[model samples]
Target: MSLSVSAVPPLLPAASYEYRTVRPVHHGHMGEPRTDVLAAEEPLEISLVYGPEEARRRRTLAVTMRTPGDDAALAAGFLLTEGIIQHKAELRAVVPCPDVTKAEERGNVIRAELVPGIVFDEARLERHFYTSSSCGVCGKTSIEAVQAASCPVLPAPAPLLPAALVHELPQRLRAAQAVFDQTGGLHAAALFRPAGELLLTCEDVGRHNAVDKLVGHALLRDWLPLHALVLLVSGRASFELVQKAAVAGLPVLAAVGAPSSLAVQAAEQFGLTLLGFVRDNRFNIYTHPERITG
Candidate 1:
């Protein structure tokens, strides 16, 4: 159904940093207490606002726990990957909710205004919007439900990447992890060219959130359908990570850790090049091995 929203509030600045203090005990001895910088983990309520200014409607599409920063991209990437919005042009503006009275709620809520005549799928959102940091979907009757909502990832025409280039990606990803370096507590996702050039990197308390932020950044730049890029994650390859890569049209997904059974299955089904244990200049190709050049 087409929804309408009247006035969109000004956009809120992205919050990428948060702090917490902790005491350290090491090697059977008590260490001095210190403040640590951490990736900000907060709930961002994504609302879909559309229609004319005179008559408006707003629906809370999702409330995801993400590391705050690139929130507009996060929300846009979430909608794109969820099959809610197809392209960036469908988005009019993303604004923080002005109705919130609390100070903490200032940047936690954002409304994405869709262009006129675009239909907002309320039922689809109702089925899949309440996502946590660890899981994206909860109630699914069958695999088809999940499959139906997935974005299509087409195979790359030239399916070969140098093994040496692949080996260098994890290091580049690590180099870009500013948050992880300080806190040593955030997961990261990065995009790279086939030749190992790092394009973008994002860190979050949640692995999937990192991927979402990366994909959302790409979405804002009109860089969807990432067929020529390789995606590297700092953690294990989960089904959700694979799904986000698939939605973004990334052909190669490499992880520093192992891949789950479902993750391998999704990669197989979607023609993704899935790699795991991607460290020490060695990695295992779980699916679509043709994409990796030795």
Candidate 2:
């Protein structure tokens, strides 16, 4: 499903709309019922708008089930991690598709306009981009298939972080998760300086989307090649999370949960410092421990 080009609407702030309602839940032994706030989950259709100004084209890239906040950053980050755009300058603008008349559809369809002269690879589009909430790169057939979609992440030369600083990150990351605090049902991704200060944080129902939002925020701010900072995820590290961090040139990735076997492999292959089970003042470094100092 593609959309035709029209007058671009003013960029709206990314927002998370309520998709679920709270109901009273009665416990077996409790007299009073409790109410719960669930994280909103909805489909966001990401589309690509590119070509010469006179002869432009649009294509629906992917439909992802994500929490609605930071939709633009999610789209931009998706492209950046997919190797569709190497730098922030490649993107002209990310706006809600104006052709959709329904108010509900307005923010759900995002159009990523490319800078003039950059070619859009339709073949690559056919191979990658479509994803689900559980898996971001479901189209990849093999390990090489995944590696082909992204450039190798180079090793960091400076800004070595202390091991103690690394352990302190999860607490800082947890403190910044406002949405998760309310719902207790969202995943978070945070960017941190080597000295242990939080740079930015994003949350979503999908762990991958959270990472994408964080990467997209950095991309929009011209902060690519994030070699001097660490990326921390609130859930167990997966292959897709590692891939996104690697594409953004993030040198260190720490997770509060364990990492999958393939995630560890990807981190080792990309020379990224992958930490797992980072809680209670302890963490296990799965790869590239050299980047973490005493």
Candidate 3:
């Protein structure tokens, strides 16, 4: 479903960026096309407000590059995945930075302020080191730290209908990708019920953020214990994406592309039913195959 946001001023001045791609023209042939389109990435600063003062205790948290919608959920999901704030109640609100220029005017920065009595574990966040759209686990303090903090997969009986649902996810996800159809430059993540209904779907320039938005939406709607839903992505499964799915209590994850070894390992450790190359009528089961049924 398309999200409707109240009219706001332009997040960035009108500007265009050039995007290039090569496409197959015919059998054994390819061609490069130079194209230009309006740039979409914008900085969203998240700030937290806490306290009996309720008016005070304002602080800047993280700046992110996003498509300028679902700011609140994006902030919440980022905080949850980063292990910043433990629960949704800790986050009072998310708003644009008052001093955007003072913070960072780039298209990839946002501020998040927190509520009082809700002290974030700066140590953990620093340890995680906010990752960008293109890289995950790049700036972490230690591999062991991630492994140590890594959550073990939930051990539940694999679903009897999981495999068939996994196979159906890619086409469902593609059918729901309205934003991607328009931009052709975005990634998507979706949550599907065991019976094949889409609970929520979100798209973004970054795959991680897309998943975050979906999780954040679930959190806002108080849909914890995500075991009943299967999480699907439009690209290769990454470690961070898998981590987000696990954190949200999703037992199964399916991707239309390859699964990075680290991601597969994470899924195995977390006991998440992992499927990759989920196109056509077949899919590759990486970790748990028992959950999928005929």
Clashing pairs counted in every model: 5, 0, 19
TM-score of every model versus the real structure = 0.86, 0.86, 0.76
- Estimate, for each residue in 21-135, the C-alpha lDDT of model 1 and write its tens digit: 8888899888888897766678989988876666667888878887777677778888787778778898888777788888988889988898877876567756773343356
lDDT of each: 0.77, 0.80, 0.67
lDDT of 2 by residue, 106-184 (tens): 7789999999899756798786743433564433333456577665756657468899888888888888877777678
Tens digit of per-residue lDDT, candidate 3, span 82-159: 666556777666555555565345433445556567765545543353343365444232223444553445658745
Q: Give the best candidate by lDDT.
A: 2
Q: Model 3: residues >4 Å from true position, as ranges?
A: 1-39, 48-60, 99-113, 129-152
Candidate 3 or 1, higher TM-score: 1
Q: Please report the TM-score between candidate 3 and the true structure.
A: 0.76
Give every collision pair in model 1: 4-50, 4-51, 4-57, 5-50, 161-293
Worst 10 residues of 1 by lDDT: 1-10
Residue pairs in steric clash, candidate 2? none
Segments of candidate 2 deviating more than 4 angstroms: 1-27, 33-35, 129-141
